[model samples]
Target: MRIFVWLFRAFIFFALFAFALNNSQEATVRWFFGHEWRAPMVIIVLLAFGCGAALGVLAMVPAWWKHRRVAQRGGDIAPAVSDAPTPTEVQTPSGVRDGL
Candidate 1:
């Protein structure tokens, strides 16, 4: 399984590398403040993709860290409370009461 995953990743990497190599023609990219910069089309696309991926990872880091911390604490967190009453308790039309 691990070998398959590695091979898949290598295949994707080579595919993207080939794409970048094939599409190295310079083109103008518009930026904020009416700025235009010339860069390879593949580089611009990859840069945008890398930035989005980085932002996604950054957003998940805090939640992932919190989960790790809770797991390391060894179940010190409070247990969930059940809405249903205990079997020993008696239910009345008005409310619940202690069982005889």
Candidate 2:
């Protein structure tokens, strides 16, 4: 299993390596007011992917901080409560069910 996993990882690496080699051609990115940026296609793609990932993480920062603050305040997620009485034990086709 480990060998297979390693092989799969290697395959992925080589695939990406081939992609980069194939995309070695230069690319131009146009910006506002006749501004232009240029780089190898692979580098441009990598930069775009990296920036997207970074922006995604940055967008989640507020929610992450809020959850962290709640955790620090000991705000645990309690189980839902019900007014009706629940059975202590019940029989099922597989096995006995005791809510566990």
Candidate 3:
């Protein structure tokens, strides 16, 4: 399984490499104040993808911090669940029938 995963990753890497090579044309990015930046199309796309990934990680920072804090305090990180309750042991609230 690990070998297959590695092979898959290598295949994807080569595919992306070939795509980048084929799309080496210069592309322009216009900014405010009539400014423009130019770079290879592949480079621009890769940069945008990287920036988006970074931003996505940044967006999760607060949730990660909350989890870290809970873990540091040794609080209940998981919701309550006992091993496995038998049908008879599981309780049903009033006005609800167990259909026994």
Candidate 4:
């Protein structure tokens, strides 16, 4: 399994390496005020992907904090029904029970 994972990683690395080598041409990014920035196409693509991912994570920060706060406070969401296991219920080793 480990060897397969390493092989997959190597394949990905070489593919990306080939892409970088093929796209070494300069790319231009023009800003709002006619400002232009130039860099390799691979770098531009990588930076764009990195910034988008970072922004996505940043956007989720508030929701994550809210969930954390609720969890720490024992989410008293809808009151537990008379029969079902509540969120704090202890379970078996597998943490699952067969319905049948």
Candidate 5:
């Protein structure tokens, strides 16, 4: 399964590589802030993908750091729940008897 996944990834990488190589038309991208940047269409696509990935990782950093800190502190901050019930004497219900 792992080998199949790796092969699939490799195939996709090569396919994208070939596509970028074949399509190298220069294009200009207009930013929302009135800035225009020119680059190959493939470069722009790859840059947008890279920026999205970077932003995703950046957004996760704070949560990851908090989890790491909690884990490093021996996980003492988490609440503990007991699975066992409290010790109490059981009483037979009315109209129920033993050896019936």
Candidate 6:
């Protein structure tokens, strides 16, 4: 399974590499206020992807911090529940109740 996953990843990497190589033409990004940035198509795509990923991680920071704070306080996300009988409720091998 691991080998299969690695092969799949390699296939994707080669495909993307081929795409980038074929798309090396210069591209321009027009920003607000009539600003412009120019770079290769592949670099622009990668930079946008990186910025989006950074924003996604930033959005999850508060939830991650909340979980960490709860952990530090020794709180269980889900409390344990025990339903098994106690030792005193067990029956002895001699056919007598242990507690009574």
Badly placed stretches (over 4 Å) of model 3 are 78-100
Clashes of each: 0, 0, 0, 0, 0, 0
Give per-model TM-scores: 0.61, 0.73, 0.74, 0.68, 0.65, 0.72
Residue 16 lDDT, candidate 3, scale 0-100: 98
- Cα misplacement distance, residue 34 of candidate 6 (Å): 2.0
Q: Rank by TM-score, descending?
A: 3, 2, 6, 4, 5, 1
What does candidate 6's lDDT look like per residue over 1-100, in tens digits?
A: 9999999999999999998999899999999999999999999999989999999999999999988998999998665888878988966687666478
Among all candidates shown, the one with the greatest lDDT: 3
Q: Give the range of the ten consecutive residues with the poorest summed lDDT in model 1.
A: 89-98
1 or 2, which is superior by TM-score? 2
Report lDDT (Cα) of residue 94, candidate 5: 98
| Model 6 stretches astray by more than 4 angstroms | 78-100
> Among these predicted structures, which one has the highest TM-score?
3
lDDT of each: 0.88, 0.91, 0.95, 0.91, 0.90, 0.93
Off by over 4 Å in 2: 77-100
lDDT of 1 at 70: 93
lDDT tens digits by residue: candidate 3, 32-92: 9999999999999999999999999999999999999999999977888877988889888
lDDT of 4 by residue, 20-61 (tens): 999999999999989999999999999989999999999999
Model 1 per-residue lDDT tens digits across residues 1-100: 9999999999999998999899999989888999999999998898889999999999999988887899898765557887787866846666656594
Worst 10 residues of 6 by lDDT: 90-99
2 or 3, which is superior by lDDT? 3
